[model samples]
Target: MITEQIAKDIWELHSRLFDHRPILQGHIRAFVKEFEEKRGTREEDRLNKIKTQLNDMTDKYIPETETALDTFLTNIQAKVKVAVEVCKKIEEKENNIEVGFLDLQRQRRREEWDVFMQEQFEKSAKVDQDMDIEMKKVSAEYEELEKKIEHISTATP
Candidate 1:
């Protein structure tokens, strides 16, 4: 098929690019040019052909299968059931992985928030202690001034 042919071509190109020995600049340039040409040529035509073939196969095969004998119908039905089950399993696994990843992210964020709150609390406590010390010093100085005023007023009398 075209897809199989494309896969083979891609593998061939990959093998050439990843050779064990040192690759020359000239070889690299040649490969790049070849790849670009292949990519640029007839892409639209190739895609259209693929689409047309798929549509044709679907239109041609499905109704014929539906109207076929019992054995053929049974086989197609079995294949379809298997396909559906496999798809459902894949979807379930994907959902599980997503849920696990989200839970991990939430836990990490919670830890970060806890650390931030602890740091802020420590800083606030330090500020409060500093303010308390300053208030005590001011109060002592005020008491000393009051004692001096009392002594002065008694001596003048």
Candidate 2:
């Protein structure tokens, strides 16, 4: 993208010079030629310096960013895993309580209530699992974007 823009800018500069053809005739062309050569050399040097700076910036950030991402992912994964386990344990305890209540109400018509409660518990578990999965996917995508941003910032002047 930067290359294309640079090419377009150069073309526009050339076109502007040609548009004033009469004014740029004879000695004017020689003078413009010298000026352009000097400008081109200066621009090249500037671009090289900018490229070096970009390289240095990228070198400074890449490893630090990678380490940060790795640490973040590990922390999030560990926390999520712990949360899911705790949630599962809580769900099991709730299920056991429901079962015990159902047993006590076995003589009564509580079948519908038992079924509804079980269904709700299952739905809640499913929702929790889905949310965790979504969060993991989002985290992965964020990491990828970070990498892409770093690559683009480094590659472009």
Candidate 3:
């Protein structure tokens, strides 16, 4: 459950980063395009005005883009840390549950040494196998998530 929540949070952060990236890119592209188009125009005064407007837009948006990128990175870092912690907690919980099951099996065997040993052993073995499988799956998922987060962190827009 915690892993799922972490995944969701990470995905939401990824979505927000992508959403902001296109807006920033569009603004920058527009400023460049207008500046380029006005460069060869015969109207000096109009060209100067357009250049000034483009500069102003660049000045405004560059800082905003930097800040947004910083915020996005910080958010992703925090979420990844949280996800790692959640995975650790889940591993701990699984260990505790396994131990508890072992104790229950011992108690069951003690209560009826001959009657239920085979059934209990088989049940316990099956559960242990299932838990092992689940742990492997969770580990693989966590690894994949970590890789994705790393890619997101290092990727250039």
lDDT of 3: 0.92
Give the distance in Å from residue 136's predicted Cα in candidate 2 to where it truly belongs. 81
Q: List the residue pairs that clash in candidate 2.
A: none
lDDT of 2: 0.92
Q: Pick the candidate with the highest TM-score.
A: 1
Q: Count the backbone clashes (under 3 Å) in each candidate.
A: 0, 0, 0
lDDT of 1 by residue, 1-157 (tens): 9999999999988888886445676788899999889887779779989999989879997777767856687898999999999999999999999999999999999999999999999999999999999999999899998889998988896
Model 3 C-alpha lDDT per residue in residues 42-145, reported as the tens digit of each score:
58778799999999879998889999999899999999999999999999999999999999999987878766787899999999999999999999999999
- What TM-score, over all chains together, does every model reach? 0.44, 0.31, 0.28
**Global Cα RMSD, each model:** 25.0, 39.5, 42.8
* Candidate 1 lowest-lDDT run of ten: 17-26
Write the residue-wise lDDT of candidate 2 on 40-71 in tens digits. Answer: 99999999999998998789888789999998
lDDT order, best first, reads 2, 3, 1
| Candidate 1, position 78, lDDT | 94
